[model samples]
Target: MLVVGGITRLTQSGLSIVEWAPLMGVVPPVGEAQWQEAFDAYKRYPEYQQLRPTMTLAEYRFIYYWEYAHRLLARAIGVVFLVPFLAFLARGYLRGPLLRRLLLLFGLGALQGLMGWLMVASGLVDRPSVAHERLAAHLLLAFTIFAVCLWTAADLWPTPAPDEGARRRLRRLHAGLVTFGALLVLQVTYGAFVAGLDAGRAFNTWPLMAGGWWPPAAWRLDPPLRNLLDNIATVQWIHRTVPLLLLLVAALLVAGAWRPAARAGGPHRAWSVALLAGVLVQATLGILTLVTFVPLWLAALHQAVALLLFGVWLAWLHVATRARLAV
Candidate 1:
C-alpha cells in the first residue's frame, strides 16, 4: 500500500479520483460509461485543465488506476488489520497498556486515511500538487504508524539479555541510537519536502548544486528562513546532508556497541550492524534517485528503503531500550 502511494505520487496520479468514497470506492469503473464518468469528473479539476489538458481517456485511466489501487490497497490493509485486532481484543489477548497502545495505533491509522484525502484535496484546489507541508505530514504520519507498530511488536516479543560487562558501552550506544532515530525522522521529513517541491529535479549533479558547493538560490528566498523549508535547493541540500550525518553517527553507534570481552555478543551490536546496512542502502538509493532525476522505479525503491531504514532503527532502539531496562 505504501509503495502504491509512492507510485501514485511519482506518476502525479493522486488527484485523479478527487472524491473520497470509503466503502463505495472499492468497486472500480465497470464499463466505458462509468470510466468516462470517472474521467470526466477528473477533467473538471485543475490537474486536467492546467497541467494535463491534452490527456486522453486512455492516459487518464493510467493515472486513475494508480490512485485507485492505492486507495483500494489501503482499505484492504485496514480490513486485514482490523479483523485480527478485534479478534485479539475479544480474546483478551491484549492487556492494559498494550490494549491502549493498540487503540492508539488504530486511531492513527484512521487519521492517516483522513490525512490522505486532505493531501489529495490540497492539489484539487488552487494548485496542481499537494502542499509541501501537508505532504510531509501525510508521509510522516504513515511512517509514524509503521514505527509504532514495530515498537508494539518489539515490546511484546522476547529479546536476548543485556551483557553486564558491556552495559556501559551499550548505554552509550543506546543514546546514540536515540539521537540517530530523531535525526532520521527529521531527514525523512525534509525528504518529503523535497519531493513535494520537485526539488530533486533542480540540480541533478552530486558533490555540488548548480556548479557550486552551495547553490546560491538555496538561500535566495525572501525572509531567509523560509528557504530552508520552501526553497528547492535548500530542501535538497538538507536531504543530501542528513544522510551523511546519519552515516557518521551510525559509525559512532557501532563503535560504542562493540565489546571484545563480552564475546557472547548483544542486541545492540547486532541491531547496530543492521542499522548501518540500512543506512548505506538508503544513502546509495538517494543518490541514484537524485542523479537519475527521480525515475519511477528508483524513486519507489528509495521510498521503500527509507521506511525499511526507519523500521531497522526502531528495532535497534527497541532492543537497546530493553537492554537498558534489563541492566
Candidate 2:
C-alpha cells in the first residue's frame, strides 16, 4: 500500500480522481460512462485545464486508476487492520500498555488518511500540483505509521539484552540515525518541490544543475529562505547533496556496529549490514533517477527503497536500545 501511494505521488496521479469519496470511490468506474464522468470532473480542475490540456481520455483513465487504486488500498488496509484488531480485543488479545499502544496506532492511521486528503486537496486549488511541504508531511505521516507498526510488532517478540556501555553508544547511534532519516525526508520533500515545479524537466544533467555546479542565477532568485524552498536550483541542489550526508552517516553507523570492542554482532551486526546495503542501494537509485530524468518506475522504486531503509534503521535502533537495557 505504501509502495502504491509512493508510485501515485511520483507519477503525479494523486489529483486524477478529483474527489475524496472514501466510501463510494472505493469501487472504480465500471463502464465508459462512469469513466468519462470521472474524466470530466478531473478536467474541471486547473491541473487538467491549464497544464494537461492535450491529455486524452485514455491518459486520464491511466492516472485516474492509479490514484483510485491507491485510495482503495488505504481503505482495504484499514478494514484488514481494524476487523482483526476488534476481534482480537474481543478475544482478549490486547491488554495493558500494549492495548493502549494499539489504539494509538489506529488513531495514527486515521490521521494519516486525513493528511493524505489534505495533501491532494492542495493540488486541486489554484496550483497545478500539491504543496511540497504538505507532500512531505503526508509522506512522513505515512512512514511514521508504518514505523510505529513495525516497532509495535517487534514488541510482540522477545528482544535482546542491552549492555550499559553499549546502551549509551546505541542511544547515540539511534539519535544519529533519526537525524539522518529526518534529513533524507527533507531531501525527499525537495524532490517533491522539484516535481511540482517541473524542475526535473529543466535540469537533466547530473553532477550539476545545469552547465554549472549551481543554478546560473540562483542568488538572483526569490528571497533567501523562500528561494531555498521554491528555487529549482536550490531545491535540486539540496536534494542531491542531502543523500550524500545520509550515506556518510549510514557508513559511520555500520562501522560503529561492526567494531570489535562494540561486539555489535548478532542481530545488531546483521541490522547494521542491512542498513548499509539499503542506503547504498538507495544512493545508487537516486543517482540513476537523476541521470535518467526520474522515470516513474525508478522514482517510485527509489522512494520505496528509502522507506524500507528507514524501517531497517528504525528496527536497528530498537534492538540497540533493548540491548542497552539488558546490560
Candidate 3:
C-alpha cells in the first residue's frame, strides 16, 4: 500500500480522487460513463484545474487508477482483518488481552483510513498537494498499524526464560528499546515531513547540502522551532542527522543486550542484531534516496525499508518484553 502510495505521490496521482467513498469506492469506474463521471468530478478539484489542466480522460484514468487501487487495497486490508478477526473471536481464538489488542489494532487501522482521506482532502482545496503534516500522519499511522500487528504476532511465540538478574537487565534493555522505538517513530515522522516538503530534492549532495555541510538556509524558517519541521533544509538536515543518533542508540542497545549478564538469559541474540541491521539498511536507503533525487524506485524502496525497520524494532521490543516476563 505504501509503495503504491509513494508511486501515487510521485506520479502526482493522489489528488485524482476528489471524494472519499469507503463503501461504494470498492468498485471503481466500470464503464466509460462512470469513468467520465469520475473524471468530471476530479476536474472540479484545484489539482486538475491548476496542475493538470490538460489531462485527457485516458490521462485522468492513469492517475485515477493508482489512487483507486491504493484505496481498494486499504479496503481489502480492512476486510482481510475483520472477517478473520470475527471468526477468531467467535471461536475463542482471541482471548483476554489478545482480543483487546486486536481491537485496538483494528481501531488504528480504521483511523489510518480516515487519515488517508484527510490527507487526500488536503490537496482538494486550494493546494495541489496534500498538507505535509497530514501526509506524515497518514504514513505514521500506517506504520503504527504494522507495528501493532508485529507486536501482536510476537506475542504468539514462546520466549526464552531469563533468571531474575537477567530479567532486570532485560527490563532495562526493553526500556532502552522502547525509547529507541519512540525515537525511530519520530525519525520516520520527520522523514515523512521531508517527503511531504519534497525536502529530499533540495539537497542533492550527500554529507552536505548545496555544497555546504550545513546548508545556510536550514534554519531560515521563521520561528526557529518551526524550521525543524517545516523548512526543507532543516527537515532534510534533521532527517540526515537522526540516523547517526539511531545508530549510536542501536549500538548501545545491542551492546547492553549482549552483556555477559544480560546475554545469559534473553531471547536469541538475533533480534537485537536484526534490528541494528534493519536500521543500517533503512538509513543507507534513505541517504541513497536523497542523493539520487528521490527517484520513484528509491523513494518507494526507502518507504518499504522504513516499514521493515519499524517491524524489526517492534520485534525487538516484543522479544525483550517476553524475555523479561519468562520464568
Candidate 4:
C-alpha cells in the first residue's frame, strides 16, 4: 500500500479523482457515461487545465485508475484489519493496554483517510498539484500510522529478555533511535518539497547540483530563508545531505549495540543489525533514485524502504524503552 501510494504521488496521479465520496467513490465507473462524467470532473481541475493540458482521455484514465485503486486498497486494508481486530477483541485476545492501543491504531487509520483526501483537495482548487507541506503531512501521517501498527503488533508478541546493565545502554540507544527517526521524517518531508518543486529534474547529477558543489543561485531567493523551502536546488541539497547524517547515526547505533559493556544479545542484536541493514538499503535506494532521476519504480521502492526502516527503528525504541523503565 505504501509503495502504491508513493507511486501515485511520484507520478502526479493523485487528485485525478477530483472528489472525495468515500463510499460512493469505492465503486468505480460501471458504464461509459459514468466514466465520461468522472473524466469531465477531472478536466475541471487545475492539474488538467494548466499542467496536463495535453493529456488524452486514455492517459487521464490511466492516472484516474491509479489513484482510485490506491483509495480502494486503503479501504480494503481497513476492512481486512478491523474485521479480524474486532473478532480478536470479542474472543478476548487483546487485554488492557493492548486493547486501548489497537483502538488508537484504528482511530489513526481513519484519520489518515481524511488526511489523504485533504491532500488531494489541496490541488483541485488553484494549484496544479498538492501543496508540498500538505503532501508531507499526509505521507508522514501514513508512515506514523504504519510504524505504530508494527510497534503495537511487536509488543503483543514475545521478545528476548534484556540483561540488567544492557537495559541502561539500551535506553540510550532508544533515545538515539527516536532522534534519528525524527530526522528521517524531516528528511522525507523535505523530499516532498523537492518533488513539488520538480527539483529532482534539475540536478539529475549526484555529488553536486547543476555541476556546482553548491548552487549559489539557490541562496539568492527572496528573504534568503525562502530558498530553504521553495528553491529546488536547496531542497535537493538538504534531501541528499540529511540521509548521510542518518547513515552516520545508524552506524553509531550498530557500534553501540555491539559494545562489550552493553551485553546486548538476542532481540537487541537483531534490532541493531536490522537498523544497520535497513539504513544501508534506504541510503543506497535514495542514491539510486536520485541518480536515475527518480524513476517511478525506484522512487516507489525508495519510499517503501524508508517506511520499513522507520518501522524497525520504532520497534527497537519501543522495546528498549520498556526494558529501561522496568529496570
* Number of the top-ranking candidate, with lDDT as the measure: 1
Task: Return the TM-score for each candidate structure.
Answer: 0.95, 0.91, 0.93, 0.92
How does each model score on lDDT? 0.87, 0.80, 0.83, 0.83
What candidate 1 gets wrong by more than 4 Å, as runs, is 165-167, 259-266
Report how far off residue 49 is in candidate 4 (Å).
1.1
Residue-level lDDT tens digits of model 4 in 1-327: 888888888878998898888888888887888888888899898998998888887888898888988999999999998999989988989889888888888998899998888888889889898878787788888887887788777777875555677566777687778878888888889877877777777777778777888876878788999988888878888998888888888888888788877776667778888988888898788778888878988888888788778878888888787787667
> Number of clashes in every candidate structure?
0, 6, 0, 0
**Model 1: per-residue Cα lDDT over 1-327, one tens digit each:** 678898998998999998999999999998999999999998888889999999999998999999999999899889998999899988989889988998898899899999999999999888888898998999999998998888988888977666675466566676788899889999999988988999988899897888888887778978999998898888888998989989999988777667564342565678778888889999999988989889999999999999989988888777767776887
Model 4 alpha-carbon drift over 4 Å, by segment: 88-95
Tens digit of per-residue lDDT, candidate 3, span 1-327: 888887888778898888888888888889899999999999898888887889899999899889988988888888999999999888888888999999999899889888998999888889878999999899888887877777788778776556666576677778788788878988988988987888888878888777887878777777889897788888888888888888988888888867886663444367768878988888888888877888888888888888878877887677667666774
Candidate with more favorable, higher lDDT: 2 or 3: 3
Estimate candidate 2's alpha-carbon lDDT, on a 0 to 1 scale. 0.80
Q: Which candidate has the top score in TM-score?
A: 1
C-alpha lDDT of candidate 3 relative to the true structure: 0.83
lDDT (0-100) at residue 236 of candidate 1?
Answer: 88
lDDT of 2 by residue, 7-27 (tens): 787777889977778888878
Model 2 stretches with alpha carbons more than 4 Å out: 163-165, 168-172
